[model samples]
Target: MTISALDLAAETKRLLTELGVSADRYIGGTLRVTSPVNGNEIGVLKEHSALEAKDAIEAAHQAFLEWRAVPAPKRGELVRLLGEELRAAKAALGRLVSIEVGKITSEGLGEVQEMIDICDFAVGLSRQLYGLTIATERSEHRMMESWHPLGVVGIISAFNFPVAVWSWNAALALVCGNSTVWKPSEKTPLTALAVQALFEKALKRFVAESGAAPANLSTLLIGGRDVGEALVDHPKVPLVSATGSTAMGRVVGPRLSQRFARSILELGGNNAAVICPTADLDLTLRGVAFSAMGTAGQRCTTLRRLFVHESVYDKLVPRLKTAYGSVSIGNPLETGTLVGPLIDKQAFTNMQSALEQARAAGGKVTGGERVENGAGDAFYVRPALVEMPAQTGPVEHETFAPILYVMKYTDFDQVLELHNAVPQGLSSSIFTNDMREAETFVSARGSDCGIANVNLGPSGAEIGGAFGGEKETGGGRESGSDAWKAYMRRATNTVNYGKTLPLAQGVRFDVE
Candidate 1:
């Protein structure tokens, strides 16, 4: 069963209204918002121009100056309230995510849960923004390093994990005493609007309960590349945390660097998983299936490549094929549907192009045929499982679709080499029961990706760990650990209490 355009639109309108977004405020505009489930126009938004984006950045900068003076715990209070607001509207917002991004119901809710989790994490982080005291050589001298909020934070998010990625940065940035300006993907602006509306509610409550709060703490810029570029190039925006394609990163990174601005780029990933001879076939199958096919393989951490030991290769491949054949693909909102439609016709076209290249590279492909759901213009397809001779061009490059390239390896050492050969390194996993193999896979010389799992697949990452990648995936981290430091600036200080000048390395310069 598929959702009709009218039903989808009605559902979207209801969700938005429930989340405090009035229809007349955002529904009439030149930019059309559509659901990937049926390719139906869900809403319309007036795109923010480049000038408006710059004004938003300036407003965020001014808000940051005031917000930074607030006590750290007080800043945390606002995030705590935001968490409450997100919890209250999780269902409405999660469904909006599913409608906009084509995520399954569970995945959609999981994304909102991520937002709430990050808010909780940031609330805790607010009081724990620690500074370090260094030992001084000179008598009666003290040295330390402190953190202060950077100006405005610019966030550029993609369509796949629309709301979650923004929260990862915004929550941390807020706790760090920085204001944010967000530019969501053109494909999924409604979710951004919904999130901002919820945030506004949280802010209002915070102001009523607390003494003061910045009204422009979080601003949304809805537009295309031009608006995003304005955010990246703005001098007031000292840091820009962007999540999108490597191609987008290639442009964003340089533009920021030209101004010496900081960037946390969450780019593309060609993730892979290795299966050992001692691996539990049942556990490995479940891990591989969800990681490869979940969210239609649009996750940055989606497992796109698989390496199985020759001993278990023949056994696992057939089981995987059967599993792929049994997967239910249809409307994402429907229960029991494991796979949802790709974001649009372009995504379908890209998937087909990658499959053709895989075939030319001597691959045995199974599935990947388009499914004829009743929804008009929705692009649903069966996930493809390909047995490849080697890691060819198509296998190495990241394709945002449900295509898993499988290969067999006789030696562990050689397989590790093949795993790290790709240009993009985001997430990787190895399924092995052997203690030595498991340790080796996660060891210093193990999977080269930023996130390496012993028995788990790489798709779902928790908020407690720093998330990102190396190489072309952009060597930037977000979500947890010391990721909050990226949103602030550091300063070193030396104070002398005695009437003597202090010098480092036993070298002193005395002013005459």
Candidate 2:
């Protein structure tokens, strides 16, 4: 297959410039591309531009025809080239992620690495993206099924793990042959820009490496919720993918259904980690800390609810307090800072509400405090642990903060029930040495989530494992060989060649 940029000159910067965008806060004044984590002010974003939104959709629609028309192999080639570029920019991208989202330096760097993996996986797995061929009852008839990319895909990404999640859509969209319009969370636009810039550079190389068509076929539109809503409802946009809250999913899911378009809705999770009496308390606590505090517990898959076996509940609480206490809290840019501020002012507000609500519900706050004084400029908060009979907190209603709720459960069935109580079913974990209990949880409650692990944190998503919540996690599957296939429609070609072929027609009659 031939590979080339849709147009070599059609780089993201070129297009943005032609669209009359200035480097200085390109879209508007309300949306500044400031680093949410480190406080660097070097990026550009469209705060809320109806015009930019319209332009992005129009551009994606134009690119859609050619991108969708491109052969799958050629698309894969471009994605492969982009992956190479991602690898090269790891250091810079890591810094950008840290600056933009306040991700711990290591975790921030890890996001770029993960994105690279996704790119490589998406590109290399093109062969698996296929359809089924079946023989018909009649000698002359045959049947085929294939995957096809929906037109312009609109991806609305959250602030946390900006690089990783953005690639989830762009790489898959390109590999499946669909033009994409990326609307990153306004709070962390820098990471998205850095990732995209690197991707385009790779695409340019891809076009030169293999002569085909323009490879930079995707465009990014940054703005607030209003901008996202515009993209979702756009007539030209046929596919929508959102990584956000259950409430956002509730609103967006119904809206897309009305249009009869495909939507990959990965919503929030009140994820749980069940710690058994026989497991390693230290290890389990350490692992759960990844989700409860990682990225300040802002991810859709953060470990919000922790269920402990009655035998270990008392022992684990203080251990958790000490372990969580060790996290260094400060500016994201500060060297060795363990935690950064929440994504933005709104996220800070959400965390505060969760704390207040948890206290109202008779939950005890063992540790954790709010930093940054409620100012939107730098919304930072310490990791929180609330002791609750149930997983109750501001998070119960959807706080999405850096807080963990500890619940004590004595029964296996009750643990399963507690885990499944949330509307979301994205990620969950179990800390257990008892093989039987682990087996039961895996068998009985496995259907409730996309990824379930034993002795692991809910936040650490595996590239090899399939991720998609049952109810709101989107009907589509991604992150592996199956991802490309989901973006494509399958088709099969049947040939008779005049050779003797068995038909089911006579066989069916005989069976009857």
Candidate 3:
């Protein structure tokens, strides 16, 4: 059933009550949440204070002490239950995510599905947190490495992917025997509360069936910079996983490093796609359209830059313009709407400002005008296209919006340089039928991104691979592969069974 806006609001209130999180729970200040869909006031949240944030950290740390001893397989079972809870609440929580974070209905549900998928993945990963066994130099000595859980894990997520990012970190962290304390984006606190409530429900069920002490394995702190800073600087939080802009990563990366704590930062992506002359234009058009405009182009992996072979540059730009004109822009909850409003006026302003700069820098910009249909100051704009003479100027950096900057390339090396020119290198793709070109793009000297693709756009990463990037994009992986290892510490053990005290390199020491 398609939930009405009124029903969603009521569901949110009920969820807040059930979760024991409302305006009264926070003392910092009131956060009035306005829906970007139609500029309506959805709800208000109480911002958490520093003391409350510290208390949450303490709770997660205390929980970690027992959680680490629960055995990895048992932890996986709990994650399985969390997946079930997410499955049960998928629609409602997905709808809440849409309402709170300006995601369209389908994208919202997909985000929830991502959470469920990660839970399932983490459950499987519980038993597979493998360590390496080493060959010993001595005859009677065996050496191996064991993985132990890190203490408290701190997660700071962005508004664009409020729930999924948290689950990506928390699910693996939990299965790896670490408790989590999350500080979700203040703009999307309701979704965080809803997810936390569901997680707590799953935790309760696990304890009931297993007869284990109910540890507060997961915690949510709803607030702004104060709470986030507290979480990042807390001595107990040995690892902090953050997902946001490069500027934010610059701040978070240094803070975590100063304390010698590990940080998994999934930061910004000025992702690009290079279209060769021999590329499949039809498929390339579809892939680029979604990559450039999906979620109104707010995705970190969104294809913000396009490098087209000069031979097909003339053929592609017009088709891209036609595609842009067909994109449906309206209320995100509506049936056929594809492009939703920006997160707020600031995002809209960013889009406009970026376009203006593009125009001033010898670039031709089409679309990007504000839509003033009956939505009442809600920020909406047509997905923009900027034809640039070179990859310099405004196209050099990332502006989180549906703006695609197209540049023509003459040579393969030039195209690769254009693709790698941007500072952020999260995801990159090249469309070509030539095997040599395809192989070259994926080679060590080609794309410098963490993810590289052939005949595909630079978005929609699967959960199986480690997702992150190089340089300013924050070289931290999350959401699959051996990313679970980040949540644990490794200790090498040596066993000597033959009862002889020996020193390395045949150096012997005798003590009385």
Candidate 4:
């Protein structure tokens, strides 16, 4: 149920020490966690320790040789077990995520459940994986391409979504038959360890008890930034995957490229929600709220920008303001909290700077409040609304805050133009009642993003959908059929049937 960060940390540290893991001093007298509901700081251990860099790699490398041989079906079974453990640990992980990452309990639970769903879906998807056979004209040759593993995969996840992002990499990579070395967000290693425990137990249940899994199928490394860097750059890691801001993605992407390693970087999103003239006012307002404020607007898929047609801007803005006026705040673990604090002071500062930038750039600030800290004191900046930019400022940059920007658009082409203005096009939306405009956006301008929402709320981006973006959105999509393919290396096997001679075609082999 609901618990304080201090209590959770005390219990967790006790658990870690008993398990032979070392806990480090949490910096700033804060546990590196702030309530999204109020930005309250959790004064607990900020750092975590486990195996060293070499050990992390060796574990992953060892797991790979044996894991790669397991059939896909067995992989599915392991994932299934992983989902169950996640479910069993739901309440604990949810509160842990809330404190460490500044997500409200609802948002934290959403992430926990979504990760569980992703693991379950990934498990079953293994049954449909098959090779493709093709006929070549070269001397009647038949060629087939089968997918294979890329050995050890290293996934570096972000603090914003410690569980979902990790599962995004682990589920696909594992089900595709690759062992992984995971480094969770350094700031929120608590939940990651719980997740790792679940995975460890699941791997044992599916692979060992079933008498089919390899001896070492997976491993987790809980440490600092250096640990993450070491995990990714290790020569033994054949592939690398990261989900975070674009700046960090740049650093890792190049290193992987230099090493000739396969890499996938699902970076940032300045996602937008554009309400067309034909959009339903009531429906559109609700959709914008969900997109704009979901997960305290920390998701890469969160709707950060809102472009409403002048046709409906006047009708929508004030109504949205009215709806927001009643928006709940404070206490993430409380039953009725609507919005939470920024992940931490850094996030709060970023939000404050961005809000001021927007205001200096001629945007208006609606409301700004401070979140309550653990000692029942204020910690983070509350949800805020910035008026449309007369020009443009940090809105172009990915500002992961509960603060959202509202812009007024007048023309059909302008709606698309404004939506495309975002350089980091991770996910965007077009709220319209017309199927024609929605289809056109989906077919034409829609290709720019990894996730595009139409009619649906922006945060409702599906897990089974194709999600990869053009330009700064990073390479190779995660979540969907595309994800499965990205985890594989294709090998073409060809056999010549030999050309049939005219005499051979007319004669029987037995000469009966």
Against the true structure, whose TM-score is highest? 1
Model 3 residue 437 distance off true place after TM-score fit, in angstroms: 0.9
Q: Rate the local accuracy (lDDT) of all candidates.
A: 0.93, 0.72, 0.87, 0.72
Clashing pairs in 4: 26-46, 36-340, 36-341, 37-340, 37-341, 38-371, 40-373, 373-377
Better structure of 3 and 4 per lDDT: 3
Q: What 10-residue stretch in candidate 4 is worst by lDDT?
A: 34-43
User: How many residue pairs clash in all the candidates, one count each?
Assistant: 0, 22, 0, 8
Model 3 steric clash pairs: none
Off by over 4 Å in 2: 1-30, 38-48, 371-377, 392-395, 445-447, 472-476, 491-512
lDDT of 1 by residue, 1-512 (tens): 33654478888988999998888756779899889988888998898899998888888888998999999999999999999999999999999999999999999999999999999999999989999999988889888999998878899999998999999999999989999999999999999989999899989999999988877999999999899889999889889999999999999999999999999999999999999999999999999999999999899999999999999998999999999999999888888989999999999999999999999999999999999867768899999999999999799899999999999999999999999999999999999999999999889898899999988899899999999999999999999999988988999999989997666788868887
- Where is model 4 more than 4 Å wrong at Cα? 1-51, 371-378, 389-391, 497-512
Model 2, residue 400: distance off in Å is 1.3
- Per-model TM-score, in order, reads 0.99, 0.86, 0.96, 0.88
lDDT of 3: 0.87
Q: Could you give me the TM-score of model 2 versus the true structure? A: 0.86
Every model: Cα RMSD to truth: 1.0, 7.2, 2.4, 5.1
lDDT of 1: 0.93
**What C-alpha lDDT does candidate 2 achieve relative to the native structure?**
0.72
Better of 2 and 3 by lDDT: 3
